[model samples]
Target: MILLKLFWSFFQIGMFSIGGGMAAMPLIQNQVVNLHHWLTLTEFTDLITIAEMTPGPIAINSATFVGIRIAGIPGAIVATIGCIFPSCVIVSLLAWIYFKFKELTVVQGILSGLRPTIVALIASAGLSIFILAVWGEDGFSTNPLTINLVSVLLFTVAIFILRKWKPNPIYVMLGSGIIGGAIYLLI
Candidate 1:
């Protein structure tokens, strides 16, 4: 029964999350934190960290983690089904029409408009993550010095490297995990 519920929950998320992983964050947060009582806000934020350090889409990684955490392996399977069902249905329907209309001028114009909106959505998600990561559980920036100079430097360096080098995202995730772990140990 719980498994069914988990699967259904994820299916809903996948089905309705129009803009992909980033857009799903708010929905996931609402379910995990407010609706289901599966995890607290702090836990939800932490899960984002785990998702980033894992190798997959944020939505999928989050569903898997929350599902497993809530009800072990069975829960994980359920949640994954839920998360994927929406995408599968939507993609199949879209695919049927996509090829036919892809060359149309109106379709092209719509896509061009959508690109910026998608980018804005992604940027908003990033800001949310930044708030969660730096502000901690109380949602207050708890940095002793008001700002972490090292992190800023690292961020600039990372941006520079990424701009100049088309490195695989997985490699970047791994490197970030290592650096985060190192920083944890150091501080």
Candidate 2:
């Protein structure tokens, strides 16, 4: 039952999410957080951190992680299939007709326009994660008027510095993790 549930949940995600990886975050969050109650917001953040650090699509990694959490090895199998099946089918079909239809103006136009939508979806997903990271601590009392403002300011400053200096994303993520850890300890 758990395996079936995992499969169905991820299949729905893979089927509906029109863009790749980051574009899938919102729906994945909704299913795992709101629908299934598989993990809390804090847990989702942790899983996302691992997903970002690992190879493979974020959505697939998330599905496997959540499935394993639910029902171990079998759950993982189901989730891997759920995440992959749609792409396998779609790509196979497209491959058969892609050459013949490659010059179709409508198809070309649709693909071109999809780029912006994909970017927008990924940006919105990032914002959602940022919101979660700011205030997802359970039972930790934070003064919204003071601490929240500090956090927001720090986040803005970090982004500004990152953009200006242009360092490796890995280093930035590691730095953020260290800072988050220190803040948690302090609070």
Candidate 3:
């Protein structure tokens, strides 16, 4: 029953979450943290961090991590399949439809309109993550005592490095991780 539930939950995530993995973050949090109570908000946020730092889509990485935590290898397989199944079907259908209607003004207009919505979804996800990193699961508070200054500092430095150097992201991530680890050891 748990396995089935895991499969169904991820299948729904894959089906409804448009605009790629970042857009799916909120839905994944809702399902795993709010609905299922499989993980706390903090845990979900941590999982998102791990997922972002790993390979593959964030949704798939999240599904696999949760599934393994819940029910080991079999659960991971079922969850991964569930997460990818909808995308497989949807992409296939859309490919055919897109080719068939490639020249239609209505189709082009619809596609154009989706751009803003997708951007909004991605932005919302990024904001959620930033909030989580800065304030944890408790969310923002009027008192500055609860804010994570280390996270904020790291975030600012990362942005500065990106804007200033324009180096490959792999180096930035590695440097951040090393800096974060050093800070962790110091404090």
Clashes of each: 4, 0, 0
TM-score of 3: 0.94
lDDT of 2 by residue, 1-187 (tens): 8788899999988887778888988888889987999998878878888888889888899988998899898898898799889878887887877777988898788889988988898898888776665654442345574335545656886788789999987787688778867876988
RMSD values for the candidates in order, in angstroms, are 3.2, 3.1, 1.3
Superposed by TM-score, candidate 2 places the C-alpha of residue 78 at a distance from the truth, in angstroms, of 0.9
Candidate 1 residue spans exceeding 4 A from truth:
103-106, 140-153, 164-173
Best of the candidates, TM-score: 3
For 22-119, candidate 1 gives per-residue lDDT tens digits of 87787788788878889988788788878877778989999999999989998898898789877888789878878878888997887688777767
Full-model lDDT for every candidate: 0.78, 0.81, 0.91
Model 2, residue 15: what's the lDDT? Answer: 80
User: What's model 2's TM-score?
Assistant: 0.86
**What TM-score do all the candidates reach, one by one?**
0.75, 0.86, 0.94
RMSD of 1: 3.2
Which rank order by TM-score, best down to worst? 3, 2, 1
